[model samples]
Target chain A: MKTALRPSVALLLIAGILGLVALAFAWAGGWLSPRRIGGAAIADALQDNLGKPEPGWRRAHAKGLCVSGYFDANGTGTALSRAALFPAGRIPVTGRFSLGGGDPLAGDGRNVFHSMALLFRLPDGEQWRMAMDHTPIFPVATPADFVSLQIAGIPDPATHKPDPAKLQAYLAGHPETKAFMDYMKSAPLPSSFANGTYYSINAFRFVDAGGASRAVRWQFEPEAPFAALDKKTLDAQPRDFLFVDALKRLSAGPMRWHMIVVLANPGDRTDNATIPWGAGHRRVDVGTLTLDRAATEAAGDCRDYNFDPLVLPRGVTASDDPLLPARSAAYSASFRRRAIEGPRPDALTQAGEGGAK
Target chain B: MNGPDTLFAFPARLLHWTMAVLILAMLFIGAGMVSTVSAAYPALLAWHRPLGIAILVLALVRLAVRLTHRPPPLPADLPPIQAAAARVSHYLLYALMIAMPLIGWAMQSAGGYPVILWKGVALFPILPHDIVAYGWLRRLHGLLGYAFFLLILGHVGAALVHGLIRRDGVFRSMAGRGG
Candidate 1:
């Protein structure tokens, strides 16, 4: 037992331990096995109440107007990361702008969450795809909570609308939802998609050239000042008034937004999408996004893309926000369901005619 | 090799004690996290993630120390097979210590989650965003946690045998005190 140890023993021991660790990790990390839990059930639960979308429309952003745009980065983006889209160059962009409700035919005059999804096709042919909502904060912290939120919002057969009591109970149970409710009440509503600021809501890490990383949240703020429609004007507008207004405005001239990236300071909450980092965080105006024209959904370049938040480029990476992975999984499940459902027969024809007009 | 001069260096001993407390706290927090449906779940998750990352960093430092500074040899009176088993178990402990946090990180990253350490400080992802990959990593992280607990039990048992029954200095080399 009185044996002298060699220096080689240390190397062999370290390497052997590391090798075993890698193998164990691979087996556990699913390198050796397939996943059992899927977002399929969560997707089904979310869509169950909404019913199937009209064939040609998206399952989620069913009522959307697509647009083509370009992102002109200020070159200052290099100070943050080496993302190809950041250099002083213009990147072609295709995206959709829509209201939040699942119903394609929901009236524009109704109080609803608005959103946009963008795909910036980089010079290298790869893309940075992102989905953003007008709200500064999401209603829930995790996908499970979101599914529960959706189930709570499902209309009771007897009420023809989600039971107010159920919603109250759900809110009582999930107090994190109060932040979103507060935002809806306090935040200004935009007159058009052209005017509203769209927030990514989730946190992402931006790596600089030195391999150091900073957590960031970005928002697309309109170049035009935010103008809220008064209640009287909102009530005066027609069902498709918002859509028509955006179409006319974009057709007349380019609608522009500043891509504002906010860096998280120490103690900022990055994991909880429902929580907002303080407004005082350091902000960087990375670029301008301009949309010149709006196209009908069927003839649009962005009709097929899912706008997955995880579809990030090399410079930007997702944060451990539970919502990020949940969103990706749910998006996949939604995408599959839509593919299975197929497009409507007359949808393309109608879209063409609409575009021509 | 048999004297107090060979006891663990102060930094090594400090890391060992700190990590032992953290790993145990993490296990309890993790268990509480999975079982809770209350609002406290997120709070637990917030602690669990940062603590896991801290453990990973410290474990790497500890491993480097182990590689550079050879520990005191086992007593000559100890059986050869028992000595070999001791080496093997130490290797297993180190492996679990190093691998557990890393896989947890990879699991979160594969799910397209930022491995937020504290405040806004986040670790770069080791894996790409893939739900299937995330699912696998998650399950693996859970399974390995159980392995970690069992190994700790064995480790503690062996330490007790060296300290209490064998009247050997093996335990004191790391613990710095003999009962």
Candidate 2:
């Protein structure tokens, strides 16, 4: 009995040891698993940190703008005046902006939101894409949400007019859009193009030469303070008031805007576009962007350019934002579709032509 | 007979062959479902959940049988390292078989998605909604899938080496004789 018990006890001990080892291995594997953040986190971090400016922030801001390929050298030694940020560089970019469909020709003086796509071809040839919106936060977070809003806002085919009822219902369904809508409704339209501020809606990783990475958001603030447009002034202005204002500023002396880089806490999700980042995460200015030259229509200055976010520097990488991936897919599909259909000659030519009733 | 003169007993052999056929069928069905796009594709997906549960249940039974029954000893001429490797590989295959289905089920549950094993038959209750947990599980599922693929490749490669290069009866033992 003693001998039989010893063999059985030894077998049980071996099995127990093996089982414990397996459990330990599984536990360690699980603990070492990688964690990924979505696009919403990126957007939040960028928006939360973009209010104040810093010294290194200007170069970083300029880097982002340069990456967007929006700024060019004016040949007068000033780099910002030129319309093309990168003259002969190829960097994929995608841009989306919201404009009132009710009169492509009517200058209602209502505030328009523009999301700029800037893809920069770095010296190392890596592409970095930036999604810059006129407002700090986008109205909607996801493509699905955006599509729903768009569907609700679309005009009836038969009537060729927007259905107010549908629009109201849509807005009611999505109460989360209230903050964005409030900002849009309350923020005064810039009377002059130079007064407008552009924002990076998504958080981006800024890797320094030392390999230290801090999440950042960027803002382009006009040197001149904002002058709000009144109803009388808006009505008096031509339909192309915004475009003309931009062209006039360019035609004048070099246009300069301070580029502000805002630093953010890596883990914070407050400013994630859907939710507003509180005062604690205030933006600090980093640098200045001086536009020294304006491009003529003959030079294809206003031609459609795409900006993609997957373009990053050797050190800089993207956060796994759900919206970022969805946006990337949607932008790629839209850009490919648009490019195949050729440029919108009418919209491009309209700004320079200058016709008034 | 005490048992077959193999690493596996009769019950283990039956379980192994049954699972092998079912899992092979599942892999083929999964590949086909992914490639084919039709109205019936959702219907095919509907079949996956039930089949996966069935496989999971059978794998549990196999594990239980393996724990109770002592498998036949390796060939006396087999090197200690090679025999150890064979045992480890078999254990890994079993571990993966047990894990993959559970991970897939957890992913669906975490995503707030239904995991209907059969028409109106729910094998497990839905997990509470948690985005972070869902993301982690999704990434985990993807990582494990690659590992499973690699292990399968290694297993197949080792089997071929034994059958052809080493000219060992390891493959034939599993393949059965008189074929």
Candidate 3:
């Protein structure tokens, strides 16, 4: 019983114990984790490269046309997800078709990234919102890389084009972009929005009622069929040809897309956004997305929504995809800015009433 | 190892101290995670999650060990009030050790965020995803986290008193050489 220890020694020992506890905590919490990146910072970086965003416009996809429709769940997805929307029912949907750019006036003649965002209203009053892209794979893997790519896109004031040196540096660091660039060279640019297959390139988990789960990615396979146009053919069309073409197509009847859920096999990369899942995987045609009424931002008010891909129903949840939360954070940041800016009637406000951009 | 009548079994002591460190870190990490939306949020979160599940697993093993190998009794000369306080506090600690992680897992599940530990590794949600459930579960998790923190302070404060001031073997029962 070495109670012969002095008061100062005892107090110092106690302090040492507490300090060691704190040290252990810090070592685990700080040493193993990555530096946090705020969504607002991502948005700021995006806007810095893309130009001052049009007031009330989305930070990533500014120019968009709204369409209202319904999703008819075919019950096939019920085997994959326990979500209420999958039980063979019709769910109301509000969708927006947009081009991925900061500028609302960016030429439609140039083949840029096309985006399809959807907001589905479930019977339980919960909303499922997702923003998908025309490409099967995202060009960049992480938010930092995404921002770096955006910075590479920034135009030099004198030259009005990105500095070749910066572009080269980005390519060297992110060969994923180089691969994406190679694919884009030969990839078909959709002649119309209705012709493109929009994908949720980031993976998610679909949990069935039996408590089973699977890693999956989903896409809207167009019923209109795939049609690709060359740059020269696209450049010959009108400046607002994409939107004009959508309007003309909607005049016929409701446009349709099959919701195909692509299953991931064991060992497939779930955290990566740059790699598309290879073929020979099981695909489930889960539902049908029927887009009927087309409207502009003023009329459809798709501008009022965030379309955060993380907004999922009960049966679905985010996977280990690193980009999923980053995308969500960036979307939240962009949405927060739009909330502060307030909705403003843009040049396309009269588009629903037969006006031009 | 000391007899069960003297000190806790070695595995029990090891788990107690190891979990002591993990739980302390978890509490602070949880605090930092909620208090900010800073760039460190995700990093803090990454640590918070794995640590939580680890604590839960350790808690289960600790519980089994405790049930099978009874803890040594308090000192014979201890005052009645202090002994009762010891028993109650110890029980509460065990309850909290298990509850904290279970509640946290449910809260994250309700919020629709998967509790991912590593690349493609995750724990399934124990509860259904409902915003109302998520909202209340979140509040409950926050409340219990503070309660858990306060209990640790009392536990540590008393252990110091027994070791430094009172010079009782109670502190040594878990912290020192074979009792």
lDDT of 1 by residue, B1-179 (tens): 44556688777888888998898677666654544323344456669888988898899999998888777778789999998888898898899888988888887676545565643456777987655566566767777887776676667666756654564677788887532
List TM-score per model, in order. 0.60, 0.47, 0.63
lDDT of 1: 0.73
TM-score of 1: 0.60
What tens-digit string does per-residue lDDT give for candidate 2 at A1-357? 112235445445545654564444343333222232222322222222332222111101111111112332223211211112223332332222223322334353655554344444333323445656667776776545655665566556667666889878878877767668888878876666567777767665555545576666667777788877784565676665565555556556655555565667546562256654445565644344555443422233223333455334444444433455545434333333333333333332455543221
Chain A TM value for model 2: 0.65
Assess the local accuracy of residue A236 in candidate 3 as a C-alpha lDDT between 0 and 100.
Answer: 78
**C-alpha lDDT of residue A161 in model 1:** 81
lDDT of 2 at B177: 48
- lDDT for each residue of candidate 3 in A1-357, tens digit (9 for 90 to 100): 554578788778777876675555444334334454557667877787875666656788888888889999999889898877788989999889998887776667766788899988775446678899999888888767877788787888887787999999989988899999888777888888998999998999999989898899999999998888777777677666787778778877889999999999988998888998989899999899999878777666476667878767778888887788777768756765665566555435543433442
lDDT of 2 by residue, B128-148 (tens): 634335556656655665576
Interface RMSD (C-alpha) of each candidate?
12.8, 20.4, 8.1
Query: Which candidate number has the best lDDT?
Result: 3
RMSD of each: 12.2, 18.3, 9.2
Candidate 3 local Cα displacement, residue B106, angstroms: 24
Alpha-carbon shift of residue B101 in model 3 (angstroms): 24
Error of 2 at A103 (Å): 8.5
CAPRI grade, predicted model 3? incorrect
Ranking by lDDT: 3, 1, 2
